[model samples]
Structures are given as C-alpha cells and as structure tokens.
Target: MTIFLALVVGGLFGFVLDRIGVTNPSIMGRMHALMNLAVMKTILLAIGVGSILMFGGQMVGLVDVGHMSVKTAYIGVFVGGLLLGTGWAVSGYCPGTGLSSAAGGRRDALYFIAGGLLGAAAYMVTYPSVKAMGLLEKIGGGKVTIGTVPGSGYDGLTGLPGDVLGIVLGLVFVVVAFALPERPRKGEPVPVAAE
Candidate 1:
C-alpha cells in the first residue's frame, strides 16, 4: 500500500514537473544562465510552502518527527553537492528533472540518466577507498539539526525552536521568490518558455 501510494504521488509530481516546463532542457539551461527565472521562482515557492506546511504540521502534532531522516554531515556530502551543481549546470537536468524529462519524451534526458547511472556505479566501486580516506567521517555531530525541536531525538546546534526557525526561513524564501525578476536586466532577451 505504501509503495502504491508512493507511485501515485510520484507520478502526480512528475506530471506537475512536466506541466511547469521543467522537463525541457532549454528551460533549465536558461535558468542556470540567469536568462530565465520562472523555474527558480517556482522552486523557491514550492520549497517555501513545503517548509511552512511541514514545520507547522509538526508544531501542531499533525506531522511526526519520526518520519524525518537527516543525513550525517561529512566532507563527501559537500563534495557531492558541488558535483551535482556542476552536473546540473552542464547537463541542464538534475536527477529528478532528468527522469521527468525522459518520461516526457526527451532524448537528451535519457543520455543524462545514463551518465548519472555510470557516475553512481563509479561511486559504488570507489566507496571503500573513499571511506578509508575519511571523506565519510561525520562532522559537527552526526545527524544534528540547526535548531531544537521538542520531542525530537536529534541534537540541535542552537537553542531556537526548530519549527519557528523553519517557518522564518520559509517566509524569507517566499519573499525572495516574489522579489526576483524574470531577467536580471531589462535589456536581456526574454527566454522562450518551453510550454
């Protein structure tokens, strides 16, 4: 039942991605180049709203903290994030977008997916050596949060309430999304919307 629900939710999410034109690599490229900001705004808005709902739900006892899984901080995580950012900029598709694009009949996204699978395989092959190099060593206390939440077992780096902090950050993201312009400059050519 859980798997079925996940499939349904994932399919809906992918449909939303396609509708938003994120399945188009050109749209993603323009986003990275700062020639188009609709994607960025949409992403920011989604994150902001999601954060608010999640944290607020937790505070109201509607959401359980047990469902949260925070990855332990390590050097490798940061390195991987940099690599992912570079890949997104170069390929114009991140993992989720790549999958959605492929579903939407994009040939380029299939290539991106293949490359990602190869990269993952390479990582698996090198995992033993990478671990030996201490890149996976936990830092700043494993599985720590930025702020404390009542009833949550994870350690917090600060005394502030996690729910409050989350809501504040969400509000900030929402404001920034609204404040951002379509193009950085007035004279720049308007990017062609894929849909």
Candidate 2:
C-alpha cells in the first residue's frame, strides 16, 4: 500500500511538472539566464504552499511530528548543494525534473539520469573513505530547524515559534512569486527548441 501510494503521488507530481513546461531544458536554461521567471515563480509558489500546509498541520496536530526528520547541517552538505546547483544549471534538470523529463521522452534527460546514477555509484564506492575523513560528521552537535517548534525534536536556529515563522515566510514567498513578471524580458531571444 505504501509503495502504491508513492507511485500514485510520484506520477501526479511528474504530470504536474510536465504540464508546467519544466520538462523542457530550454525553459530551465532561460530561467537560469534570468531571461524567464516562470520556473522560479512556480517553485516559490510550490514551496510556499507546502510550507503552509506542513507547518500549519503540525501546529494543529494533524501532521505526524514523530515522522518528521531533519538533516543535520555539515560542511559536506554545503558542498553537495553547490555541486547540485551547478549540475542543475548546466544540465537544466534536477533529479525530480530529470526523471519527469525522461518520462516525457527526452533523450538528454536520460543521459542526465545516467550521469546521476554514475555519480551516486561513485559516492557509494567512496563512502568509507569519505566517512573516515569526517565529511559525514554532523556539525553543530545536532539537527536543527530554522524556527522553534515545541515538540518537533529539532532545535530551532531562530527563537520564533515554528508555525508562525513558517506561515509568515510562506506568505512572503507567495507574494514574491506573484510579484515576479511572468513574461520574458524584452529583446531576449526565444530559443527555437522551446518554441
């Protein structure tokens, strides 16, 4: 049942991603170039809505606090994030978008997936050495959230109440997403592939 639910949810998510034109590498490239804001706006809106729902549910005891997990901050995490961003900008696909694009029949996306798997395999092969170097060690002693939630187990970086902070941030994101211009900047050349 859990696997079935996962497949259903994953399929729906991929469908939505494809419908939003994110499956197109050119659209993603234009977003990185700052010539288009559609992808950024879409991402921000999704984040805003997700944050509101998750935090609000937690506050109301609808969300299972016991099931929530936060990754501990560490130097390797920052390095990994930088690498991931670089890959996303260069390939125009993050893991989720890459899979969605592949499912949509993009050949380049298949290559991206292959490269990602190779990277992951390399990481696995080097895991022992990486762990010995202390790269896997958690920094700051423990896991943390950006805001305080009374029973969430994560120590908050900020003193603000978690749900309140989440809602405020979510609203800000939503506002910024709405304020962003949807049209490409004047004089920017549209890619032939995107058309």
Candidate 3:
C-alpha cells in the first residue's frame, strides 16, 4: 500500500512538474541565468506551503514528530551541496527534474541521469578515502535543529519554538514568492515560451 501510494504521488508530482514547464532545459537555463523567476517562485511557494502544513500538523498531533529524520551536519555535506548546485546550474536538471524530464520524453535528461549515476558510483567507490579526509566530522552540534521542537529528540541551536518558527519562516517564503518578479526588470531576456 505504501509503494502504491508513493507511485500515485510520484505520478501526480511529475505531472505537476511537466505542467509547470520545469521539464524544459531552456526554462531551467533561463532561471539559472536570473532572466526568469517562474521556477523560483513556484519552488518558494511549494516549500512555504509544505513547511506550514508539516509543522502545523505536528503541532496538532496529526503528524508524527518521531518520523522526522535529521542528518548530521558535516563539511562534506556543504561541499556536496555546492557541487550539486553547480551541476544543477550546468546541466539544467536536478535529480527530481531530471527524472521528470526523462519521463516526459526529453532525451537530454537521459544524459543527465547517466552522469548522475556515474557520479554516485564514483562517490560510493571513494567513500572510504573521503571519510579518511575528516570531511565527515560532525559540526554545529550534529543533528541539531534550528529551534526546539517539542517531542523531538534532537537538540536545537535556539530556544525558539520550532513549530512557530517554521510557520513564520513558511510565511516569509510565501511572501517572498509573491514579491518576486517573473522577469528581471533590467535588460529583460527573451520570454520562455511553452514548447
């Protein structure tokens, strides 16, 4: 049942991604170039709403706080994030978008997928060596949250209530998403039309 639900959800998500034009590498390129902000606005809105729902549900006991998993912060994680961001900008596809693009019949996304797989394999092969570099050493009190969440086992960096903080941050994202212009005001680039 869980697998079935996941498939259904994944299908819906892919449909949404395609409908929003994220499956197009050109649209993604324009976004990275700071010429278009439709994708950025959508992303912020999604994150805002999701954060609000998750934290609100947790506060109301509708969601299980115990189900939350936090990864330990390490230097390697930051470095990996930078690499991932660079790859996304260059290839115009993050993991989710690459999969969605391929599923939507974009041949170029297949190359992106292949490259990602190769990168992952390389990481696996070098795991031992990477670990030896001390990049995996935990930082920021390891696995701590930004604010204390009631019933969560992890420590927090601040005494602020996590649920409230989450809701506030979510609202801020929502506001910023609405505030962003779809195109840069100065020297506007050609508009991205649907393919």
Runs of candidate 3 exceeding 4 Å displacement? 188-195
What is the TM-score of candidate 2?
A: 0.88
How does model 3 fare in lDDT? 0.90
Local accuracy of candidate 3 as per-residue lDDT tens digits, 77-175: 999999998998899999999998998888999999999999999999999999999999999988988898888898888989988988899999999
Steric clashes per prediction: 0, 0, 0
> Per-residue lDDT for 131 in model 1?
96
Which residue pairs collide, candidate 2?
none
Tens digit of lDDT per residue, candidate 2, span 1-195?
A: 999999999888888999988999888988988888888899999999988988888888899877778888887898889999899999999998898899889999999999999999999999899889887788775588778877888888888897789888999899989999876585676546534
Sort order, lDDT high to low: 3, 1, 2
Whichever of 2 and 3 has more lDDT, that candidate is: 3
On lDDT, the stronger of 1 and 2 is 1
